[model samples]
Target chain A: MKTKKLINDPKVIIEEMLEGIVAAHPKHVRQVEGAPRAVVALNGPRKGKVGLVIGGGSGHEPTFVGFVGKGLADACPIGNVFASPPPDPIYECAKAASGGAGVLFMYGNYAGDVMNFDMAAEMAGMDEIEVRTVLTTDDIASAPLDQKEKRRGVAGNFFIFKIAGAACDTMKPLDECERLARKANAHTYTMGVCLSPCSLPQTQKYSFELGPDEMEIGMGIHGEPGVAKGPIQTADAVTDAIMDKILGEMKPNKGDKVAVLVNSLGATPLMELYLLNRRVKQRLDQVGVSIHQTWVGNYCTSLEMAGASITLLHLDDELTGLLDHPCDCAMFRAG
Target chain B: MKTKKLINDPKVIIEEMLEGIVAAHPKHVRQVEGAPRAVVALNGPRKGKVGLVIGGGSGHEPTFVGFVGKGLADACPIGNVFASPPPDPIYECAKAASGGAGVLFMYGNYAGDVMNFDMAAEMAGMDEIEVRTVLTTDDIASAPLDQKEKRRGVAGNFFIFKIAGAACDTMKPLDECERLARKANAHTYTMGVCLSPCSLPQTQKYSFELGPDEMEIGMGIHGEPGVAKGPIQTADAVTDAIMDKILGEMKPNKGDKVAVLVNSLGATPLMELYLLNRRVKQRLDQVGVSIHQTWVGNYCTSLEMAGASITLLHLDDELTGLLDHPCDCAMFRAG
Candidate 1:
């Protein structure tokens, strides 16, 4: 089967894409002093503020790099498509984002990211900069309640990063920022449905397979196996099936307030995503769940896969304040 | 051929999508009093500014609708999937955006849009409200230089609308706003390539067809035919092929400053768009063309088509200020 892609060498796409990103927003971001894959904020970084750092694979853009700006991640070490960034760049990001208050490393939890970011933290420690890690485990379908630690992070990373970044903007200590990020991750629940598989540039092969008339729910961002595979269903039915799982795990009360996100997974059109959002709001309204804030569109993606994910971040008073804190980044902004 | 989509009923998708957009952004936009398809900014319209109204087919998501907000378009009348909005919504949009000052009507130059918008303008005139129109013909590949007026608009609509909106924000009169929009359109050039066709929900069939191993350069956003078709090429080569025609039409000289946009037509990933941008800047660098600002993303999309478009807008001092004006909307915002 032939795959559609535009690249000179799939092998060097990371380097090329990073160069383009920095060139596009030189005033907002730049390459970390010496690291090619590590990017840092250019205009504003206050001294003695807890520096926020994020890292992950490159495919889910706007995630790691787009979030690197004022009131968001101070620096981001980018990796190849669907693969964790190298420790060298991660260490460099920590170094560049360092303030007297120290740095916090946050990212979706995967074996590769966990290992590499942990190693990078250790390397940064040798340089006398304190670094903390907050791994997002928000995909409810990835693990049972008793084993939440094993769940993979998905689109829920948006809320976690946003809250953490906003907290950091207040000049809070690194520990407080890390705590808020962990709280955001804990309150967030997400489930994704993949209608089709996405291919990598080098392989020309899909990361996973489904029939022309099938969907897989709870699929990981890297196309890892999901909880279920079923025949194609209507938008309403699909939302019901995925929401049933998310809400069941969340167990929200009638008066609970939640931030809702209906995110597109790569190739899904905005028209379809908007349609799905209508269904999501209808379901939430039926359940008496008050939507505090709603975001819909391509926040997180998996290259060209056709699918979407719904995330609900149950908010308490403190969580609400943290989320409502204003922050402006390349891909996201809130007040 | 069957198409995979996440939608309820094709007939009601337009209504559903509009509802979803407003529900998620009640603070930013709303449905016009009597017109469901005509959306207006929730913020009050000023008394003396030339109200900006834009509209076109619906499938172009943010292009025609998401741009409605402060410092951007005041209203957008939406049509069905890739079809021209009727005179009803267009007229209603003008009426809703009217603030005693005349309204400025601008949109892509499609036969349907032209005819319908003209009808709407005539209806508004009957009510004693002044309206002027500017049709964007930025797609350099759609027609030869001799037939420039026949060219279709693509991603260049972003620049045209941004500048026009900034002009309207500054309380420019209708004639001045119209002139600025026309100038922006004239200074903009765009070229697109299509690797696959997107389907309309009503018809679960691909809008057009191409070989699995081929792509069409200069294809219209609505799957209209282009100037050439060929096998898939490297990102550099594809960028070169498209830029050659654009630069030839633009004839940009050394030291000329411009805004560059590498837009995903639909399914192309950020990774690919960035790679393409790298090539675009390289080519421009070779010719001493300086990029004033750059954007890379899915600015204007065609459902889920698998390709991208590149737009270059030559900028003078005035145009640069207009582009730099801050505007916050559902899908776009800049400073």
Candidate 2:
């Protein structure tokens, strides 16, 4: 079947989307000079404040770009579709977002991103601008417990970024912000199940395929092979399966508090997410772990893939305060 | 093909979804006493303040229920999928939401909704609680200009509700709040295109059907017939067709400002919406009209249908101020 998408030429798709975002949120972000792939916040970067720079592949709208604004991300270097951006835009983003205090780079743990962002860090270092890196590895299903560092990040990036943004916006030192970001990542866990595949704009081709009645659990956002593939199950069953792995690793005690995010992969409707939330809350309540706050929506997505993921951020006093901090972004806001 | 949903039982889908929403946002809303179908904001209603109650069918998430919170809707009466609520729940919502100043009911213009809400208003009258209502008729494609009252409400309900919420939260009387809501509805226009059909939960059958390469423009949210159907066209072409109708209706002078909403009906992604936004901005620029603000997301949806809609709200000072007012809701927020 022909790919049914509302787009013009795919080559200009990323550019058009960037232009659209800028046009819609002129007060929040602007394209960086000489860096068409980088956008900097209009009100975020200030002297003596730590700067936060976030980036990832395209197609995940509102992930890397929509979060660029005051009290969120100072800048975001965008990639092409599911590919990492080249070093040039990353360098430009670092320069544009850097306040006198320094710049910090944060993104999902992917090889291409690591290589490109590292090269950008080297370039920034040569300019006497201090730089730091914090990688997100929150997908609990991507690796064994002992190999957690090898795991891929997914929707859990939302909470990690929120905490880092709060730290930077509060003028936390570079070391402190990096420490908090790492801490946030360590406390986060996520797992997802995919019911269908998403197509690429350029090729108009499906990234992967599944039977109409099938589902793949622990699938990577880029259609990477998942841990299990089987017949689709009820919402409660799926929630239990994913939460089993998360709870096994988290092992929260009674009276513990955690923030929850039931995120759509892409095409899944809010109705399904709410159904999942119902089961998630039931499981958490059984364990005596109170939910500090909950967010349910399409925070992270894989084009139009049909699925959902649940993210838990085990919270403490500091983390809860950070999560509740005021923030204003083009696509997300909290107070 | 089998319907791939994460639901346990379609019979209890609405109840489960409502339970999930309350569980995730206990601080924002709660079920009204003895009224299982009604939810009242925990922080919205106040003595001597006009109370705002918004409701409709269940499939459109974040429309009526998600907008219940401080400075937004005081209560929401939910219905079955794509159907209107019964009069008992509507009356219960009015009672629970009413402050001493009175209550204002707002919802999309539909036969069942009109009839039921009218009955609820009558019930409220016997209780000595004054009530007023303003029905939204913003879908310009649903009727001719000479018979505009016959038009249906669509995604434009977002802006209309936002304005009415601000009006009531600011302590406006029922008459004034109702007037402002009527004014907001008059200034809004919307049009939508459907690419695929959504299935009802109970039957798990498609609500409507179209060929693989076909798209229907001006389709209603509930799969009502549209004005035209043809092979899917390029994004730009489709955008032009929709914008042409909108511009013909809204003949603004140079420098006119308006708020724009590029809404996903369900399965459409942000990538497509941004593409639509790009063309939308191009079209507005050509006409010398400026966008005061733009929102692109799934504000109102038709289950898991694949489609998009564009809504424009012609803004004057009062409407602009209300749109910019602070709001804290479960699924939407602004400041």
Candidate 3:
């Protein structure tokens, strides 16, 4: 199949996208001096505040870059599509985002991201800046409960980031912000299903192959192998399958309240997400769990990959208060 | 092509979707009593305020329904797929939204919508509830400059509804709100390109057809024929073509400021939209028209159609202030 993308050249796609982002959101973000890959929020970093820096692969837009602004991420170091950023840009982002209260690095728990961000933290330490790291592992299907640390982060990262961003915005110390980030990640869970493969911009080639009538549950955002592959099923059946896995592990008691996000991976439309949400609500209702807040849209995506993910952030009083705090980002706003 | 969708019983897609929306956004919106098709905002309508009621076909996910919340539309009566709602539900929407100041009806300039909304206005009139209407005609390619009123509305409807919503929310009288709505519609210009067709829920068939290597410029949201059709071009070429028509119609002087919306119709990802925005910025920079604010996303979508639209709202102090006013909606929140 033809790529059918609206791009000038794939090699310069990231640069063009970054330029486009800064142009479109000049008031919210700006590229760091001498480091084009590092985008820092214009109004987020302040003295006496713990700076928040997030970064990852580029395809999942509105994730790292779009989250940079007041009351959210202080800076975002961008990478090429489906690839992690190098330590230089990450270090630059840390340097640019650092307030007197220190800085925290947060991103999805991937091998490349972990390695690169650790090296950047080392660099920041050598520069006499305190930097902490929190890796988000929220995808329940990637690992068993006994091995939760191995789980990959997906759309649940949105909630984790939001809670941490709120903490940082409220002048929380580095220890408190790091604790809240870990707490948010521990409470968040997500699972995804892929209907079709997305092609890479550079190669214009499919990342993975599936039969035309087949779908895959528990697929990774970067087209990693999924837990199950079978013929496409109805929306309710699919939702039930994913919810079974989540509910089996979560085991929330009655009266528990959680925030929900039915997110489109990219090509999935809002109509389908809402359909999935209907079943999710029904399943939660059957279990006597109540939804506190719900967000349905393309929050974290894998380029034009056709899929959707459901994320639940089990909220406590503190988490709920933080989740409801005002945030003004380039792509996300809430109170 | 085989229809691969995450839905059950396409016959009840709308009802299920409405149920899903209410379940997810209970704090922001609710279904009107005895009027299943009518959704009213939970916090927007106030006594003595000029109520804003916006509606249209249902396929545009966030257009009519997602926009109903505080500081936006007071209510939205949904239609079926690409069809318009009948007079009964629209009348109910007016009656439920009225706050004694009056009610204003706003939507795209479509034949079915105009007819139904007019009949609903007549019904509201019989009940002694003053009613006004403002039709958005912003698709520059749909009609000649001399025949502007014949043009169809598209994604530009976001700005029109936003400005009018702000006007009504601030307690502007019905006449002033109507004037502002008309002003906003006159200043907005939009053009779209279609890369592929979207399948209807009921039929599970493509709404329109295009060759593998072809695209149509200025296609309507519901797959209406466009002004130009030919082989696919580069992103810059496509953006240039669309901007040419919009700029020609707008003809803003140098140093003038405007707001920009690089909107995805549905399946076109943010990666492509930013690429288009890059070109759009370049084109505007060459002409010296500065962008005051930019929104890039799927604001008004046509199910899973693969395409995008560019909307420019020429802004003065009033329009700029109104655009920046805070709005808390289920799908769109902006300030």
Candidate-wise lDDT, in order = 0.88, 0.92, 0.92
lDDT of 3 by residue, A1-335 (tens): 67677788889999999888888988888999999999999999988899899999999987879889888899999999988999999999998888878999999989999999999999999988899999999998788899988889899989999999999999989999999999999999899999988888898788789898899999999988789999999999999999998888778999999999999988888888999999999999999999999999999999888889999999899999999988888888888
DockQ, all candidates in order? 0.75, 0.82, 0.74
lDDT of the structure predicted as candidate 2: 0.92
For each candidate, what is chain B's TM-score?
0.98, 0.99, 0.99
Each candidate's interface RMSD (Å, one decimal) is 1.1, 0.9, 1.1
Q: Which ranges of candidate 2 are over 4 A from the true structure?
A: none
lDDT, candidate 1, B214-293, per-residue tens: 99999999988998899999999999999999898889989999999999988888888888988888999999999998
TM-score of chain A of each: 0.97, 0.99, 0.98
Q: Candidate 1: lDDT of B314?
A: 95
Q: Which one wins on TM-score?
A: 2
lDDT of 2 by residue, B36-102 (tens): 8999999999899898889999999978799999988999999999899999999999998888789
Ranking by lDDT: 2, 3, 1
Each model's RMSD to truth, in Å? 1.4, 1.1, 1.3
Candidate 3 chain B lowest-lDDT run of ten: B1-10
